[model samples]
Target: MTTFSITSDNLFMVSLLFLIGLLMPTLQIAGGQSIGVCYGDHGNDLPPAQEVIDLYKSQNIGRMRLYYENPGALQALRGSNIEVLLDVTNDKLQELNDPSAANSWVQNNIINYWPDVRFRYIAVGNEVIPGGSAQYVLPAMQNIQSAIVSAGLQDQIKVSTSVSTVVLGNPYPPSQGSFSGDALTYLQPIVQFLVSNGAPLLANVYPYFSYVGNTNSISLQYALFTSPSIVVMDGQFQYQNLFDAIMDALYSALEMVGAPNVEIVVSESGWPSAGGTVETIDNAQTYNANLIRHVAQGTPRRSGRAIETYVFAMFNENQKDPGIEQNFGLFYPNKQPVYTINFPQ
Candidate 1:
């Protein structure tokens, strides 16, 4: 009694949904099951570590990005069940190049808290590439990996570094993305190492900076994911938001480096609520809320898989340099939400 024909669009939709189903199971293990928030304790007036953990539990936030091995924070995180993306601060990168130092660092910070603290990834350095500290990144990562293997935790935790979008030479049009010559020298081997170890590249993607840099060309609606229609068409892929376009660009860059399979984890992304251009409570809430919902849909280039992301950050840091840097937090230093944001469980 019923007859139907599957069009190309229908087939594509079916394929996408099937791929999504396959990816759903891996989300939790990969830290993509729910949105994560970066917990930066740079302000003197911030709450105690235990109170912060309690806040996270109350909000249903499933993951956290810790900037370093803060003894107090690590102690508070025990048995909390919140997956953590721990960072190896830039200052410690060169020191970690020594295998013994790396092992000791891991033994003290990670091994000491094992089973109680769920560590997902150990980012060797944050946005240190394309700078003077670039040379030490790969070595530190190698040493850390060796340490992790020695501790019998190699399979449980991944080692990588957080990089900025500045590493991209040509990022526009998404499909034509490629790493800059300067950055490739530092990133090539790192990419290979990540591919071999099955670790994702941590990237700090900030569409806010891109939009503000060139407001005439980049629209706010596109950056905020409020666009009603497709904004950019790159070959067969259609991009409706800047976040997906930027992510696809990174994906394309990885492909150019002969490591197309290397996955990307958004280590930091957020909008400021004040102290900058177009920074307002409404805009910040819109951007973050939309980002949490959109990451689950994945990017066009890497369709049907959730993109693990960490919003930067939990509280506004008064200690940070004045301006937008201090205003990216989702909550105030007093522990009150700067604006209401819902995190899906």
Candidate 2:
């Protein structure tokens, strides 16, 4: 089943994730609406947005995560059943704080093209807190919040900011977690607004980075959620798979901050097809296939919470910014499975 609508550049840009938190939602396991896909588009020579929409229908994918409100793409999915979570870049931080600017942005990019696209979430910035030298801090978040309210998008589109793992002071133990002191100055306010607005906090996690960083300590079985149930815990929480372990860590951090009910959403998570010797195709397939199944089955972790996840990508992007390994698409630019992800039956 090759989807011919995709183009060469389609595999390049995938809205990436690096940080996470907050809680709001219509979260559920496998019925009504169940899957989320990061549709990062850092490429140029790809199929028209409408063609890609056709491919999604053929595959039964209902949710799409876009890096920005590319009106052309939004227009393509209008009236379709898909839900989109559009993002904003760091460069727009200043403009985002101004209600007028945000209103204009929406009037031009969103209001003019909503309901058709059904924008459900608007991620203010991608990993802004730890954007490394481009840390947008508090203002960007406030700007986005202002825009959401001014545009009267609070009911239709929740506002959020995605963060990366680097923002954490510690993440391994799954319990001893804390935002870097520097990030707290920004996160404190962000979470405050999130809770008030009924928005979810997001994190884009990758066990791949842990495995690649400490191959000697992190086992492949652990990363693939195949590790035996010996168990790891912090206080009363028990963790088995890397996903749960990470979630527990985030949960614990929230508890520490007295925001226990704050909803945490795995905004982006996945395995890559091509990378260093350790990041092979087989490992990639195992990781993603299991993840899709885990989330699909609404399988419970040791914590007893049904895990929710968004697979990293739908297509490989050729023009994504240069990085350790950016070509992590589940499907190639030709629209063939990178391997069979086996999205749940």
Candidate 3:
């Protein structure tokens, strides 16, 4: 048998090899799962960040999306295998619009954590344009990206904003979809930024919202990702569920604007477990489980190119508004799953 002794020059190589060994298994598992979860901490009763991280690991959850740069949450995520998307909340958009402020925020929230946290993106502002924070969204995004560049972390972290499905106009035909109303002006520039930066368009697509808005027309089965009685026809495509329909519409809208190469990341999408006329444990499970399986297979129009998706929530948020707002969690406040769902290992 041959034995090797460690030397000063080989120490860094050994450490790197050990770190890679530790992370490779986890990285492979996460890569296979593809699906991610949104960690919304609005529930007073929700467990601490450490416990939440534990739950994620136990479930083999590889990706997580945070609503803000919460220190405690980021700390808990440190050295974990899960990849994260950190946010700059809508209210903070104005503050981060300035290059100096954005740099400060990056140093304080992201760079400060570094490789330990595995932060992949800085979601500049959540649903800002439609919510009237349009003026600040693009500026904040640019500033933050500039900050990342300044910090020498641009290659490791990307920047983009999460937008609502409401930004689209007449999204039915998919191919005919385009940004409408006041959104067009803001979207044109935003998409340009995304294209220039080679970042994805972060979209929060909710078939639930579409169904809620038109209950009489939108079938519950379609929203739930179950067997729909009627299949929606859009050009050469046949949509069995509403998720793909909404996604294709966004794709079409991007193509129309000459930003066809810009990819989309479904930043948030899930079914509520309660607080709605149709919301139920079974329905939530069905929608989410089917989503996991569906996203594994890319949209028909964009065959073989699976769109990365993150489910809306990890736990039921009690602090959210009454009705359907607080019930989109996959787990309870205790960190237990609301229902069983598989993440392919």
lDDT of each: 0.83, 0.65, 0.78
Write model 2 residue lDDT over 1-345, tens digit each, in one string: 000011122112222221111011111223315567787676675667888888777766788888876777888888877888788766787666676777677677777876677887777777767545334545666666676677677788888787776656666466676676776767777787778888878778787765566545555566666665534544565555566666656665666666767777777887776756646566666676667656544322223444445678877788875543466787677777667643322
Better of 1 and 3 by lDDT: 1
TM-score between candidate 2 and the true structure: 0.83
CA displacement after TM-score superposition, residue 129 of candidate 1 (Å): 0.6
Checking candidate 3 for backbone clashes, the offending pairs are 79-116
Tens-place lDDT digits, model 3, residues 112-135: 888788888889888776556788
Shift of residue 211 alpha carbon in model 3, Å: 0.9
Better of 1 and 2 by lDDT: 1
The alpha-carbon root-mean-square deviation between model 1 and the true structure, to one decimal in Å, is 9.4
Q: Candidate 3 has what TM-score?
A: 0.88
Worst ten in a row by lDDT for model 1: 1-10
Q: What is the lDDT for 175 in model 1? A: 91
Q: What is the lDDT of residue 144 in candidate 3?
A: 91
Model 1: runs farther than 4 Å from truth? 1-32
